[model samples]
Target chain A: MSDVTGGGSGADDAADSDDAAGADFDGAQRTGDVPTLSATDVEAGYDQHQVLHGITFESRDGVTCIFGPNGSGKSTFLKTMNGIVPVWDGTITYGDVDLTDEKPEDIVTHGIATLPQGGGIFASLSVEENLNVGAFTVDDADAIAERKAEVLEVFPALEDKLDQKARELSGGQQMMVSLGRAMMTGADTFLLDEPSAGLAPRLVDDAFGLIERLVDRGAQVILIEQNVRAALRLADYVYILAEGEVQFHGPPEDLSEEDELMELYLGL
Target chain B: MVDIGLFTQIVINGLLLGGIYVTIGVGFSLAFGVLEVVDFAVGEYVMVGAFMGAVLAPLFGAEGVFVIPIVLVVFFAVGALIQPLIHHVTTGDRPHPLLMGLVFTFGLATFLRGSVLTIFGPNSQDVPSSLLTGGIEVPGLGTFPVVRTVTAVFGVTGLAVFMYYLYRTRGGMAIRAIAEDRTNARLMGININRYQSIAYGAYAALTGSAGVFIGMTFNASPGMGLQYTAFAFFMVVLAGMGYLPGVIVAGIVLGLTQSFTAVYISGNAVLLVLFAIIYVVLLVSPAGILGKGEWAT
Candidate 1:
């Protein structure tokens, strides 16, 4: 297994070392703030098959990345959090509010927004229109406008293409629109599933940077990524899920120490 | 050789007929486009509207023109009420939404037609109003019936309003988003059921208005529902599923083709020509004229 603090190219090496140092210092004195979201013994699945069985985790106030293999229920776990999938048995709490078996639309009102896989951008709609739809739960016009401005500031590329159809945009640009739309909701916690699923390497870096920026702006970002190495670099905390359960939960440096987890499970 | 005057009359007639087809077909197109459900009872709804206008004409007197609003409201309510039931039955684990919609709405068509037959009998009934029996003479070309011209104007205006609403309004955007992808629309905090019900109501209003026009221009009979239904289906298919503007253009083309065939060939040849056109169009572009296969959901 590669060293957690030193691997990849020069740029990645710098990022990895920085992440490791941050993990070491932060792990010694973890913040006392209440977790934005907590799941306990959460069980969920599609029709007949249960994909997430008795899984549990707590997402603190930063970028928490969930990394796993293909059938490890990472997507299902995100869906369960967003109330798209019903929890067979377990409790999902946002702050102190119980969120078990709630409707997905209602969940947005509680300040939890989700950007599902594939970006979920409305293809036929214009970029501005897509953002408008994202603010559906918000009634005040001024607030929506303010959030739109804030989102545009974060994604300057979308500022020029506000009137263009989302489908006309490139894959990375569409992902920007999707992220921008989610930001328009002004939610404190964002659940992003595979934000960099099919993008060029440079765009992937850009996506990770944007996600990190969200954390800097005081939003709790929970992300699921297939790119293990980049995820370890960007994640403030990491959870390695396999076979519908969490096998390891720690900082990025701790993840590197688990030889079996890094080699066999993650294929790092 | 055809006389220029006669040719002009034929063209005018074709366009006017196309306008009526547009009114009748737009609702069908919307239902299919947004909901992905073929509303087989659209023609029955039209027939119901015509019958309502005919029945209420005497009570409203020459002011029976006021009945249009009432017809629109009542039909919209009826559509909203029935849509949920249709959605519930067709959207579960048993069968695909399209197949279930076809079976359910086909049954609804038969039920509605039977109800009309039971109430009004098989005889065709004419709507008794000045709005129905009048004409305006045009210079050089010919005189056109006031009812047909009014119907055409209203149809075009309604279609224009619907198009604007779909592309510009928030609610319309929600509907279009749902049409594009139901899961994503829901994720965006759009209540899919409410929007779908509203869409059904809007569709009903359009078809009901078309029925009133049909009743005023032609006589209303229970069996005429099937003919209008067939024509609406043809227009929708020709325009391509979910392509709104294409439906309007296709309606005009179909109307013109039908009119020209009836005048030059025979009235019976209209269906034959329509089927042949549909076959050729499907063979060449399975997505219809302007359809890019984007709104498959």
Candidate 2:
């Protein structure tokens, strides 16, 4: 498992380390200021229908996997954090900044990157252009190149296929592009919703492997997934949501022990 | 006996006529491609631009060419201003966002046409450019009318510039990303509204400038916009919806068909012939003439 470096600068000095392929992620590793996101009693929905009702949440040490059934409001909760969906009531704070009213573009600057279901790569864009888009907030050309270089090291297969349109890539390769695009932002925390949703059975493990790599690097991740056991393997904390509310929140071991909750919500 | 010179001239006219369509198609395609708005006001934009050329040409010593720059700026600003309105009606959990956009732009088109007709009446107004009058005579090819040649040049040049901007720049990447998935684009820290505005503004600026050149080529009149509007639609459909490179080919096909049909068939049958081709293309390859465009939704 490689430690994927996260945060601080668009151009993290991954080049400074001798083994950039495994260890160095753009920014210099730090002791603190990891910027844990805390959401309190968050309520949101589309139009008049309410999906989430006062669900308070926080990131765990490494990966916090949110497991839910379809229409469970897990995806909507992720969107609220990313600002794709607005929070009707309740406060979301990233370290000290209030993210409740912040726009999606603004949320990215705060170093929280969300990858919507199916990796969210712009299908028509070339792999290279999709990577370039990751650093959309960065102005300096050198930073973009450096961040891309760092991402390429992680998903080295993408280097050869940079010029090809993203849709042309295989399932696993598209996930790499999607992950690689997100990495371009220097995000300290990743909000991924259903990263494995559309992937083939053979590629499902590979999708979780990619997420594991983000966690191995020290980035805080809040993942929403339907794959119960696959997500549990990577989860430091587990959240089970049923009908837009948290049915359970604790260690993954505890989640398994709650036979009734697991059987009812996760269909375990 | 068939006059070879006349035939050659018709061929040249058709190709040049295609160039004019290229200008309108590129902008219309961009608006549809980037913003997903089937802007009904595209033709009115051209009409207004020609009227601007007509009204402003005299102040610039009746050189219609001088108004291109000013029209580009005015139209760009107007377009930028209008883009938010389009974005407003088309975004969020709205039912039939595409239809909403079409209807809004349709109303806008009607308003613009009515205003121009009321102000200018039904009279055809000349946008005189002494510099563009006369013909450049080639020894054997044909006499290329200077105005048509320049108009063609303007159209092709605008297409090239748009091509370069869309494919080679960061701003281009932003808009393309927005076109692909608006929510994800916002996640990438791309301000969706700003890029949409820029895309629409550039489209308006180019389309409006084409009007000035068109007015110089023919006479600008209140009733002239509908024909060009139909031609613009034909270009996009034939070019492949949202496919940029396909525009030139679509334009040439439409132009040559119009020129040849008007001469060999009937001046009245030109519209009928173009419609027939469009119908066939739609039935066969809804993706576009080259079968490379996004399937028209």
Worst 10 residues of 1 chain B by lDDT: B288-297
Query: Model 1: clashing residue pairs?
Result: none
Which DockQ-derived CAPRI band holds candidate 1?
medium
TM-score of decoy 2: 0.95
Residue-level lDDT of model 1, residues A1-268, one tens digit each, is: 0111122224554565544343221111223332468899999988789899899998966888898899999999999998888899999998777889788877776667788887889888899999998888777675567568767877888999999999999888898888888876656678999988778777999888888776766677899999878877778899888999998898888887889888878898
Model 2 DockQ class: high
> Which residues of candidate 2, in runs, are more than 4 Å off?
A1-23, A27-32
User: Candidate 1 — which residues are off by over 4 angstroms?
Assistant: A1-35, B59-64, B291-297
Measured over the true interface residues after superposition, the C-alpha RMSD of each candidate is: 1.1, 0.8
lDDT of 2 by residue, A130-181 (tens): 9989988876676677778888888999989999999899989999999988
Please name the candidate that would achieve the greatest TM-score relative to the true structure: 2
Residue A231, candidate 1: C-alpha displacement in angstroms: 1.2
